[model samples]
Target: MPHTTVLPFKALLLDMDGTLVNSDAVVERCWREWALEHGLDPAEALKVVHGRQGYATMAVLLPERPMELNHADNKVMLAKETADTEGVVPIGGAPAFMAAVADLPHALVTSADEKLAQARMGAAALPMPATRVTAELVGASKPDPEGFLKGAAELGFDPADCIVFEDSGAGIEAGKAAGMRVLGVGPRAAEHAPTAVVADLTQVRVVTDADGSTSLHVTV
Candidate 1:
């Protein structure tokens, strides 16, 4: 058993990739291919792509490129990501944590478009949350707070009442910017200084109350 901590919050906001699902292999593969094709650095490409929308990543990597070019490239990246589910799986304890939160106010907020979100979540055999805020639903991506804010609204909770689970620096920043407490997941995410950090949801359990309030018993 992992060391644990308990946080009482009324709602939950979850990041899909790296946070709930493991799709690093497919993500890195796609980004590397895109970098090679564009003569950019694959290392840097992977660094910025993990928690951002494809178009956002492309915009940073090739700022001088036309919007049409980046949009078109994003479509290609989206299609490839949707079609490639290789290595996609649930992060440790994510499924169980999700199950425990099924009755609580919770939302899945993702950088991936709707199609890719469904594909990857399906690949991981995790049920997609009904209140999902995807790239297609947001005006901006991670590090912008749009997705997490949308999630909080969709779940009918104030951002202050939500505890966000994220596995990337961009995601942690987004959550904080949305005025929520964030629980960082994964080693790569620790440097971002989330409200609290955990290895994965394996140590976290949701407690749903009769009044519909929820709290998290987390193993730190």
Candidate 2:
């Protein structure tokens, strides 16, 4: 077992894809297929797609494409992602972690649109947070602080009072930018300089006090 540290915090803000839901296989497949359709490099496309909104990724990769075309293509990609769920699953320990926080204040913050969020999370059999900041609700995505900020707002907590769990560099950046201490999820997250990093949600546990305060105990 890794060393665990106990940190008290007011609330949690989580990113969906790599943070709460495991949909990498389906995400990759959709993006790879879209890459081939657009004559783009699949490797490069995959590299930039994760932790980003579909339209934003499309905008970055196919800058020359018209906005209208990007919108249409993004819709197509969203449909494809929603319709496919061959390998969607919860990140190891995700279910347990979620159960621990069931009575605490928390929200889902993700770069995915509502439809994609519903599809992926549904496929993973994960419970949805009552408060959510989805792509459709925010003008900007991860690394911009928009979604995380929105999440904190929806949870009725100040950004600084929240702790975030995220698996991507962009998501970590967004959390920090929102003024929340972040627990970087996954090995790759270490490079992003989050407040702390953990192997997965399993490495952390949530506790609720009798006074209704919540804290996270993390195994670093």
Candidate 3:
């Protein structure tokens, strides 16, 4: 038996990787190569990769590296990631969940730039939201809260009125920092203690009220 919980919000702020889409196959493949090139352990690099822009991840893994180098290398990594979407796919129940929120107030707040975001979403067969705050739009990455804050503002909702869906520590931290209730998705997010936790989107059901209010009935 599953204990269901209902969480209400005026808008949604969504994270792409590990949330709506599972790009781990491609992500791991690319990051592994990058880690080896930089003489860092691939396993350690992977531990810091999710929910961040490429440059941010690099900075974490290579704290002594120049910021400019990280930025320049991030461009190459982005191109490589964008060019390879061989294994990109939607998370469980993501397709239906997406449709349920299609008409709702939602914005994509992702670390990936527009091109990479499009490539991954297209590969996963997920519909891209019209309101998006991509990497280029944010001066900082996840764990900094800037992207989530901007997302809430763009959707005309206060942070407290927005619900974030994420699957990584950095994203969960960002959502929390922005004062939003976060619904953690997937294994990675469980460690972060989000407002709610779900194994996947299958555990979540979105409902729209007569007054146009939206609520997520989540089975933790």
Across residues 114-189, which tens digit of lDDT does each residue of candidate 3 receive?
Answer: 9999999999999999999999999999899999999999999899999999999999999999999999999999
Query: What lDDT does the true structure give each of the candidates?
Result: 0.87, 0.85, 0.95
* TM-score-better candidate, 2 vs 3: 3
Stretches > 4 Å off in candidate 3: none
- Top lDDT hit: 3
Q: Candidate 2 on 123-187: residue-level lDDT in tens?
A: 88888988888888988767799888888888888988899888887788788888889998886
RMSD of each: 1.7, 1.5, 0.7
Q: Write the per-residue lDDT of candidate 1 for residues 77-104, one digit (tens) a residue.
A: 9999899999999999988887887877
* Worst lDDT 10-window in candidate 1: 211-220
Q: Rank the candidates by lDDT, best first.
A: 3, 1, 2
**Model 1 spans > 4 angstroms off:** 1-3, 209-213
Clashes of each: 3, 0, 0
lDDT assessment of candidate 2: 0.85
Q: Against the hidden true structure, what lDDT does model 1 obtain?
A: 0.87
